[model samples]
Target: MKKLALLLAFPLVCYGLTIDEAVEKAVENNLQIKQQEMEIEKSRYQLEQDKNLFMPEFFMDFSYTTMKDTPYTKLPAGSLPFPLSFKQTNKDFRFFDFGINYYIFTGFARIEKIKISKLDIKANRLMLQEQVNTVSAKTKKAYLDVLMARAVVDVYRKQLEAVQKHLERVKEFYKQGLVARIEILQTKVKLSEIQRNLRKAEGELKIAKAVLQNVMNVNESLEVEPVKISLPDTLNIEELYTRALSNRSVIYSLKERVKQINSLEKIELSQFYPKVAAQLKYFYTDQYPYLDPKENYALVLGLQWKFQGAAPYYGYLKRKTENSKLRLRLQEIKNDIKLEVKAAYERFLTAKANLNVAESSLAEAEEYYRMVVEQFKNQLASTTDVLDAESMLTSARKGREISYYQLLKAYVDLEKAVGGSLKDEK
Candidate 1:
């Protein structure tokens, strides 16, 4: 229980990073990840707004009109006199109206729109998850790159030391009149080459650290130490493909899109039915010597129907057409996802094979270099033989590092293809 407590508090501890810590930092500080989080929040608020569609809306309005002269209404007198007259309007007047409008029926359009808004929220969340996964994968790749570059530097450093020693021994032989001057010149050339390679390796290591620092959203230089890459004895492609279909964010987002489209189809179906709304209003008007002055209120029911336009039908038909297209697009995406997973898996297997070969070659080269060194100490092997063996051994060591890094990179790609974390298996 104590250990678990420490584990739960691990994020509070600051020190050198592991892969998981690097990923956590990236998710917390990366701009793209934060942007997606904001997008999810925006969608959540929009969903809340959509839910308010069923509630009444309040409005207040005012109007004023001006005329050149006072007006009067003239009514025809049937038998008593020539005409009847009454004051009807003021030259200038103003009125105020306040009301609450509520919908009674919308042919289920409001409900369907709300459902679609909910799906949009889900889609935004899935997009955020997708961004998280992308950042995680890229962080791991950068971490591995730092390690690989550092290893290359180490390899070149060791080779430079070995060649420097050989150059000194060659000069000593020339002084003793045992080797020719040309041999010394050759050893100097080899030493210069190793020095150049070491410098280039150092430069590469710095660049790799910069890339890693950028990915982590930090400004400090890094001396990164990461977990060793491991591969399983066997993998089942079918199992991985199945998990990807269920777990991938793109697929799930698309599924939500299909739901939204279906909801829109239902919304368009409402075009055939009348839209009904209820309203309550209160009004106040003051016009001197033109009409009676009193407070007025009313409750009204209204019905609206459209029968002439083809717009709603066209909208519904468009969604229906896209429905078939969406399904087809989803199937295409699945096939593409399967192909990506399979290709990455194949590369992983190839990298593993290459690593095996490189390891075996390193072992053989080490033994050969040792034998050659012994022979040179006994004056039985020529300087050329020793130089060749050392070069071959360094080459093999560099090759092994390259192969190891490639294998790790390939594993990362495979995990990304599946849109999940595969390091747990290791």
Candidate 2:
């Protein structure tokens, strides 16, 4: 009865952290997210490169040359003595050429390329979103782990206190000749055992904190304290699963890939058509047995046509059109995600059931401990019986604590599988 009163009087301390703060810290610190951000920047640059493809290209060339020996060379009619209009000549010459070229048309291929690049950029953005989902899940799981570890340590501490107090009472009773010395020694041993268990739990708590720190991008050696486990009463697995499928980053990325492939297919199809381009050239030459340099500056226009029979163009079109394979793969991924969501949801339900059982067992164990302690004080129960009750009560408390944490973790996994953060859902 006295032991029960003491146990009831033990206060539960709530310590350290909020869920939102933990998530914010993780987002700021996670290395993987930073890498994804870089990829987004890269994609932006690629989009810019695609835009530049439409602009004109400017080029210039200069040459200075000397021919050491004279030889016959080609010349215009009546310009040379030989009947054949040819010469091997030695000469010194300087020349420069400058030109600008722009594609006036590419059968709409340039337009398609721009579209493809835009799609790629969109895909990269979706990739970042996927990374966000993954990181958020990992961070929340790690945070819950720390909370569970802390809860376990607290439970152990409570057991240790109970056992230590029992040992003190046994010692006092022994000194008063009310109990055997063996009883006092046995209680002392039990107290020491509980202390050892407490220390082990504390060690695990430290390891859990380290894992949380890693997820949050904190220095590995830095300490972190997470929120107390105040299990939410109004849990909804169905709603969470729905949110996950809709908000998951991986799904969004896959959708982007599909769009990108669609654009690629369109660009490939454009290869079968003719292209048109505009050209202009400027040139100067000296000492050439040829037309005047001013004559080389004439404007030019060009056209390029791909024969329908061209192997490479058809090959590209064939390849891109076959991307239904990728679409089917995406569909398969969606099915797999559905199964994963189902499994996680089931796990959460099972854990919740088990927790309820554990809670009931804890209540029974506490009552049993209270009754046995009273009987022992009245000299109606043996020391072994009292010890057994203490053991039962401690075991029940520990089991309940473990089950609560496990249930909490199962909930966390379900959230991850669904791809939505619980906080965000709320």
Candidate 3:
């Protein structure tokens, strides 16, 4: 009984998840990231297959045959005695062959194909990185939302408590005939409003937690640690644009696409040239026909060229046009990135200023509320005045909470626009 009582007396502890930890969990578990990784693996395998085009291919063949009649040469009726005939081949025979085939030249088509495959692999990897960055930014924003909701709930709870305490004071004053009956009624009304708002805030907090859990792809409930509002001390717009251009995976992926297009163009150009191949073979047969060797080895070289109604030239032209389009697209992406960085930077600055204003307003509201409460106790202020002061204070607290989190979110957006963490910047 004593052990049971001691166990019941202890409080359950839950560790809080940090923003970085949440982002890591989200990235590690996201289905899109997993799919992108698979795509990269597939491209790597394709690269291996392309490289194998340069290596020799080994082959073997076997056959057994039964003829309906023996293969023979018959003498002409007037030239032969007694219509004689000579057997040329056995009725039943077996044959076997072994060979190696190699491409001596394919106008460098194989080399270009290999280069395109390698570029594909690099492009897929960059896409994966881009996906990771997107997920990380989303997770951070979700985490901040949870923190903001929790803060709002706390503010509402405190407001509820204050209103309840004031109601009791108002009731006491009414009993002593120091205040009017309407004072108690007004106080009751304020207390009820706070209770309703508190409930709403609580519900919002639950939703925020659920959203965070869903983003992290976790089954268990999450408790996130409160984060301090810390803005970067300096931000250079030009430097940020430079970092975004250099570090963004999308840009790099596009560049890889350009390289792949170049390789493809080369491959298409090679199609106009002839292909040369060599084959070496060893053969054996159970029966030999006239002038046929029972077993032998041979080396052969072959060349092939086809004219396909100007198709090769047209294909080369197509690839060249596509290459030009890709380069233009790359330039367009760079321009968009610069614009994104600029917008995010401006938002961060706005949020920062809003936070500063909210901080000052909150302090002033707190002081004003305290003074109004004191005045009410001395009968110098009415219940309406007290309620008004409390309302202003509640709004101020809520504003401060919202502003702080918005600033954090804005900073996260800026980091996302920069394509990496700003803290890593020198």
- Judged by lDDT, which candidate is best? 3
* Cα TM-score per model: 0.91, 0.85, 0.91
lDDT of 1 by residue, 387-406 (tens): 89999999999999999998
C-alpha local distance difference test of each model: 0.86, 0.75, 0.91
Error (Å) of candidate 3 at residue 159 is 0.5
Error of 3 at 350 (Å): 1.7
lDDT string, candidate 3, 236-321, tens digits = 99999999999999999999999998888888878788999999999999755664668999999999987688887899899999
CA lDDT, candidate 3, residue 131: 94
Cα lDDT over the full model 3: 0.91
**Residue 53 lDDT in candidate 2:** 81
Higher-ranked by TM-score: 2 or 3? 3
Instruction: Report the lDDT tens digits of candidate 2 across residue range 34-64.
Output: 9888888888888898898899988889988
Candidate 1: stretches off by over 4 Å: 1-15, 74-84, 287-290, 423-426
Output the TM-score of candidate 2: 0.85
CA-RMSD of model 3: 2.8
